[model samples]
Every structure is written in C-alpha cells, then in structure tokens.
Target: DVKVTQSSRYLVKRTGEKVFLECVQDMDHENMFWYRQDPGLGLRLIYFSYDVKMKEKGDIPEGYSVSREKKERFSLILESASTNQTSMYLCASSLRDGGYTFGSGTRLTVV
Candidate 1:
C-alpha cells in the first residue's frame, strides 16, 4: 500500500529561525508537493518536484525551498521562518493517474 509520512505533527519555532519539514513516501511517486494551508487563504503551493534532484518553485516559494535527493523523500526548508509562515504544511505524492496521497500534515507555529 502507498503511504505518505511526515516527520512532525506539531511544531513551534521562534521568529527568524530556520525550519525543516520532512516527508517520505513508501511508493515511488514521481510528483511531490509542499503545500501550506491557511484558514482563509486556502492551500498555497510552496514547492514541488517531479523527479529526484529536480525542483520547481510553486506559487508561494519566496521564503521556502525544497530538496528531493532521493525518490522516496522530499524535504521543505524555510530560509528564515517568520510569523506569517506559521501554518499547516502538507506533503503530498501524486500518481501518474493524478491520484494523490497526503501525509497527516505538520502544523507549525512561529512566535
């Protein structure tokens, strides 16, 4: 069975600190994404990778970066986390047929 797992379910960080969010997939999905979920703004794409060592900037990539050194793992990095960056981060893997499997999500709070 395919499974997506996130390293953290909840986190708290201070302003201006660097943050790392990790995600892993049991299935070797070619497409993966980092999405931020806000109450009113909905889901915003932060970064995505279609293949290992290949990453593309998403809609809101200003303060974030992504790494996919291995096909089964994707990492999201915050250059300098700010209060505005605090939110729920979701990691997702997509199958060729467009089916998506998402992790439980990591909720980050910046103070």
Candidate 2:
C-alpha cells in the first residue's frame, strides 16, 4: 500500500524560531507538494519538487524553503516562525498520471 507520512501531527513553536516539517512517501512518487491550509486563504502551495534535489517555488514561498534529498523524502523548512505562519501543513505525492496522495498533515501553532 502507498502511504505518505508526516513527521508530526501537531507542533507549537515560538516566534522567530526555525521549524522543520518532514514528509515521506512509500510509493516512490516523482512529484511532491507542500501546502498550508488556512481559514480564509484556503490551501496555498508553498513548495514542490518533481524529482530528487530539484524544487520549485509554489504560490507562497516567501519565508519557506524545501529540500528533497531523496526520492521518498521531502522536508519543509520555515526560516523563522511567525504567528501568521501557523496553519495545517499538508504534503502530497503524485505520479505522472496525476492523482495525489496526501499525508495526515501537521498542524503548527506559532506563538
């Protein structure tokens, strides 16, 4: 079975702290995406990678960065945590056929 696992289900961090969110897929998908879900903003894309060691800036990538060192692992990094950055982060993986499999998600709260 294919699975996308997130490192944390919930997290709390202080302002200005660096945060790391990790995601891993067992399906060997070629594409992975990072998105943050907010009340009004909906799901905004933060970063995406099509292959190992290759990343692309998504809709909102100002204070966030991503690293894809291996085919099954993708990491999201928050340069500096802010209150506004608190949200439910989702990770998704897909193949060339175009259907996505999402992780359980990590809810982060920045205070």
Maximum-lDDT candidate: 2
Q: TM-score for model 1? A: 0.96
Q: Which residues of candidate 2, in runs, are more than 4 Å off?
A: none
- Residue lDDT tens for model 2, 25-92: 99989999999999988899999999999999999999999999999999999999999998999999
- Pairs that collide, model 1: none
Cα lDDT of model 1 by residue, 40-92, tens digit: 99899999999999999999899898889999999999989999998999999
- The deviation in Å at residue 81 for candidate 1 is 0.8
TM-scores of the candidates are 0.96, 0.97
The deviation in Å at residue 32 for candidate 2 is 0.4
CA lDDT scores, all candidates in order: 0.95, 0.97
On TM-score, the candidate that comes out on top is 2
Q: Which ten contiguous residues of candidate 1 have the minimum total lDDT?
A: 93-102
Q: Rate residue 111 of model 1 by lDDT.
A: 97
